[model samples]
Target chain A: MSILVDKDTKLVVAGLTGREGSFHGLNNRRYGTDLVAGVTPSKGGQDVEGVPVFDTVHAAVQEAGANTAMVFVPPPAAADAILEAADAGVELVICITEGIPAHDMLRVYTHLRRDERTRLVGPNCPGILSPGKANVGIIPAHFFSEGNVGLVSRSGTLTYQIGNELAQRGFGNSTIVGIGGDPVVGSSFIDVIAQFESDPETELIVMCGEIGGDEEERTADYIAESVSKPVVAYIAGFTAPPGKTMGHAGAIVSGSKGTAAAKAEALEAKGVRVGRNPTEVADAASEALA
Target chain B: MDLLEYQGKQLFARHGVPIPEGRPAATIEEAVIAADEVGYPVVIKAQVLIGGRGKAGGIKLANDREEAERHAKAIIGMDIHGFTVHQLYVEKASDIAEEYYAAVVFDRGAKQPMVMLSRMGGMEVEEIAEKDPTAIARLHVDPLVGFQAFHGRRLAFESGIAEDVIRPVGTMLERLYEAFVGEDAMLLEVNPLLVTGDREVVALDAKVTLDGNALYRHPETAELRNTGAEDPQERMARERGLTYVKLDGNVGILGNGAGLVMSTLDVVAQAGGRPANFLDAGGGSKAEEISNAVEVILANPKVTGVLFNIFGGITRCDEVANGLITAFGSLDISVPFVVRLDGTNDEEGRRLLADADLPNVHVEKTMLEAASRAVELAGEAPPEDADRPGPSAGADPDADPEQ
Candidate 1:
């Protein structure tokens, strides 16, 4: 069984009238995701890619019984969309939009934690895909193949690269979750790992992290204490110069606190095979299963 | 984007944080005039982003006009942490009776703004946080309610801040938080918040990092972007909305994702090649973007080869191939290119590249092989690559693209 979304999931597309929202909404639907509703305020009677649109998330929830909300609103309005979805009884919110102000996220997160109704995946992430079952955000649906291994990463392209490597090497995935590359993402590696650990189909886990905050280190600690599944890890940015942000807002080595070396050392301490590169990571995950 | 001390203070001053009166001067004459206006015993501080200005002799007390001119002359060309100073913050120096550390920085762990205060000030905050972790008081603020005076008071009380200075420090923190939130800053700091001999709290230094994402809302702050101190390649990349960092190597690395780009750098280094730069084409990049990236990378003469390690997810490889073909028609891309395309519809992309059959392009199946090929094409001398010291990533001494 997949951890996040599966065959029965009904999705709502937030900001469905926008460029990427409508584009990815169509792509996800083409991949067989149950995108039943769309939300674009003041366009309640419209349809995008044949999905029925509503003025508000609550109206979509009422009319289409949409449980999952995929947000593609701009940065300034993304937090409001997430809050609206959470308030309107959305079970899951996957925000594919990037560049949401950190301050906006701060308030949204505080609100999100207080409410137990919804789970938000990202403000700047590729979102999650449960192999052949569902494609919630922007991850290309066809590249991933259904299998026993579960993968999670803090990066978008790196996840796709490693996912492709795994698929090419005859190792398919049960679910690959992009927890996002923002400092204040909706889901953490620990949150996804907990879900993966309980899934019977997930026999092995691959965690791809990069130099940034202490999330990897914290995840490593959690793994050492609780996880029993065969886990392989790869921390990117070993060759990256310190203090210079390597593209991602979260992928920065601040004051030597978050370095790739420190992350590798932490993970290796937890009995996780740490790969220096993606190719090596694929080999390590393959060997872990063996 | 991290602001210079003077720029940071400007935002603070706008938010009503009491700071030393200062003006940024780019020339010796301006520095002398600023020093004269501020009166003698002024501080001529290099307006660079990095810290340790005092230790690097970038900060000097100018007792008179001639001294200020001399100090400005020495500092304007001085190199600190590889950043050559081009401007100086001429400010009326304060007579410090006591120094206290205060700042509101983004704490990633908390995922919120954190207030940090310490009686032990004038030292590097990073160093203090490492060496004497408990000496500093920390408070996490909820952005929903913003920073409360109670939070600041709690920090002051916990850190054993002097009783008389509590109100001033607390008020200063409230205003600092205002500046941070009002300006959409990721990191706003006032290290060594000095209490002058006249018994008044004043920010002696400021380090503000405005949220690059939110800069669109604050066009005025966005206008303060100091492209003058940036690498020409990096500046161009920033303007084009592409993330780029120039390194001291010959292999110009381009990739779709940041993590993958960083991984490409590592793999290239493993293959005995140093990455000349880090450039992410970003997700869903079309033909035009690919062409732009190629042109930008090729513009760096130090780059002997280009490596395009693309795992097409949202960014299709076929689009990149189309971009490369379009670029070759106009751009003088003399360097050999190693292209490794994989992921969604990769074979179609590969076929397109093979059909184009550009002489300088070599398509590889694996990242390792592609990196190896790029390494070989980047002038086969790893030892010399290590020996030749190049300009720092952010600071380019001679960064004129025309030059």
Candidate 2:
């Protein structure tokens, strides 16, 4: 009943020979994700541990039947790697690489929309994890406990913090998706929330958002009309000063718009309980479960 | 990376967009010389990266050398919205037949670049958006197919652009699009895109914001980063590659990730403490980076206390603890610190902190507890050596006879 990953998922590591790529790729494999192949261009014939390596994603698809891609390439080459995976007809592409130019993602986004073959997750995201079933990106597998609540967030360490809180409260997760903190991510809050709504294993959803864009406000509107499940949400950056980016590329308060208070009010109006802080968010989710 | 007006116009000129003759001057003499060279009836504009400059009296029309010098002298050292102007853009003023607006900006909701045109220009776009939304013609340019002339023509026709100048406006729109994409700009706007008395359409003003992330590709444009106008603390943090934003408060805050740091700021505020700055050491930060962050945070004189909210994912809590210990050894830390360590290697990190027994350091188990402690520490009686404003310090302004 998980949304994206499961036991049947065959994953390929796009930059598997690089420093960060090798580390996270091996980590995902250790977590029992079905990592079948690695792509490193020149050093394609080499293998990391026991996984096979191929120069092209096409070869990985042909030889290893890799249906999913997890990219850890450097920012400059990351978009091209995602495009290559999409062109090879991989069903899903998750990019863990951060700092990709917005223009690069803009072009990639346009192509992916028209191609309609690959579902990209992030150009600057923590990736996804269907707890106890499969792990895809950089999300730590140990914090999550298998349960019925689906969690989606725009941040990484913050997601782990909330996930830890839930686990300590004896609430496990069905899936935790980090949609990224970039302005032009592949998946939006609405996209993942829609998936959670249809997921039978997911009964209550937890959303983590921050100041920046109208994505969270729009998601609140969608939840009011569509979602049947209860959603508890938390938005960071309440005290953030306007016109300054708070680490995340998308986490900025522009003028009077996109404040955390505005976002919280928007969700609360839609029958979604908005938490004042992370602890309160977990508490609200716990109460909804009760 | 919001470019100054002169810089924006320079970029527009590079893309074949017609603009008024202008020169950027850093002094009154330079401005007068530029005004003389550009001919009489010039406009002297304060070169600051803020809005409402026109309303703030930062812009003035000069008919001759005397007027230009006076305007530049009044503007070059003037402050507008906390930003002190150090430069001026002197240019030949235009004779306007009609004013129109054209811009290319990123549409975050639509996930595409949007090109907009409004017949109503010379006024703020926000005002136009509120008064008459339908007066503007907007189109989302698909990056794959790219922006076409047809799109521009359609915008002109829909916005009721003057039929006589529609072709030129369309061409200008296409050129603006080219500049927007070519320069990796987040926004490229031409406010008061003028239709002159001679029927020539030219850009009277330029507002361009280049994407900071894309600067690596354009080194020349990256040089336009003006550090002089930035907050000193923010400039210091930027040099170290740390994500830091200065705020007008007392409690200095540091954390692991953007979200966590932002959350910490809110929690601290809720606990009745205002944050002095926002600093994220970033993921997987090592001991040295943490020590560097501590140095930067403590450097702010307004900070009475600090909070370290570390929720380790890839970042190890012990490394952060080691960083704090290292900072204590190297720096003179006067402010009290509240540390909250959780996740990977939390027990070891806590043990190390306890073993260090730093007098100013306090460890808490939860975020709320840490925030409360930090706020309480900040509200306590100030030390004798604290850099608090006193009668003696405040008397310096009184000593000035100019008042």
Each candidate: chain B TM-score: 0.91, 0.92
Q: Against the true two-chain complex, what DockQ does each candidate achieve?
A: 0.55, 0.54
Clashing pairs in 2: none
lDDT of 2 by residue, B1-403 (tens): 8898889999999999999899999999999999999999999999999878999999999999999999999998899988899889999999999999999988776778889999999987777766777778888899877889899889999999899999999999999999998999988989999999999999998999988888989899999988878888888899999999987678999898899999999999899888888999999999999999988888888899999999988999999999999999999888899999998899999999999999789999999999999999988422343432211101111011111
Per-prediction count of colliding residue pairs?
0, 0
Docking class of 1: medium
TM-score of predicted chain B, candidate 2: 0.92
Q: Write the per-residue lDDT of candidate 2 for residues A1-290, one digit (tens) a residue.
A: 79888898899999898888889999998898999999989877899998889999999999999999999998888989999999999999999888888888888888888888789998788989998889998887888978998999999999999889888888999999989988899888898999999999999999999998789988999999999999999999988877788898888766666778778888998889998888888898899999
Candidate 2's DockQ is 0.54
List candidate 2 segments past 4 Å from native.
B380-403
Query: Stretches of candidate 1 above 4 Å error?
Result: B129-133, B381-403
Model 2: residue A106 alpha-carbon error in angstroms: 1.9
* Per-residue lDDT of B72 in model 2: 94
Model 1: fraction of the reference interface contacts it also forms:
0.65
